[model samples]
Target: MQISSNEIAWRGGKVVLVLPLPGVKQTPPDSPQLQALYAKLEGARSGGAAVAPRLPAADYHQCPRGTSVRWYCFYQNRDWNENVAGRRLQWSDPHCDEVMDFEVYSFAGQTSSWVNTGFLEVTVWDDSVHRLWTEAPNSLSAYVGSSNNDQARFFEACA
Candidate 1:
């Protein structure tokens, strides 16, 4: 996949890191964390649901380092209106009480790097309220000396 700043910020860096919501896949269930996210999305599907359409997974790639690369995740609501709530919605909305969660595991070498050294930024717009949250970077040093090209190729092949 082509690596673009806009795509990286909006999509989860790549498809490999993005997992589908529950009942949408035919493999083992997602992790507990993902399961919770699926629940929130399911709850947001009501007919009168004030909540917007929730996006499960979108990945993007960032080559912040000349040699190393970083992956980011994006979660957004589809039904979110830009002009609602009189332009004053709280962070916690009674109509839309669901919060989307995302996670990424970092690796250094081909093995499970087991290192966490990346962060995620979540942006939400409810027409009345706009909110942003920045998560701390997971500090995994496994990919420290890895080649960015190799990673890019892997993502491309996976795509």
Candidate 2:
């Protein structure tokens, strides 16, 4: 579940994650969110490859004032209805590569909870990929959502 640092890039003012499409049997057969992700990967690859972005500036939304020269960052959607909060307060060397814990979840209308679907160790870059790795235990589920209307959110961290 790793996309090497060289594969990540910035396009259209957003970070472009070039993901390898997983085979039908590789992902949980019942998780539509995973299926959607696979479709998205296919589309992105069909469109173009990734090119890393330029270095981030101190004034970027995610970077804390005076700390962006060596800071980790992410866009946090605390309440998905409104705007997402960009944060980059963690400290790290400007030239070092970081690994981050990433989780994909689907909203369950019946349970009113997020169902874990795909978990991966993703690499982040200060250029645009700011989240860093964390450790946690979770129970994975095959049927993450009951319908296609279920919303999916990716949770990542900056460390």
Candidate number with greatest lDDT: 2
In model 1, which range of ten residues has the least summed lDDT?
Answer: 85-94
Q: In angstroms, how far off is 102's CA in candidate 1?
A: 14
lDDT of 2: 0.25
Task: Rate residue 57 of model 1 by lDDT.
Answer: 42
Clashes of each: 20, 4
lDDT of 2 by residue, 1-159 (tens): 222421232322123222223432121111333223334443453464332223334223222122111223322222211232211112222222433223311111111111111122223322234332221212212222333112222234222
Candidate 1, position 127, lDDT: 23
Scored against the true structure, residue 37 in model 1 reaches a CA lDDT of 30
Lowest lDDT 10-mer window, candidate 2?
104-113
Evaluated at residue 157, the lDDT of candidate 1 is: 7
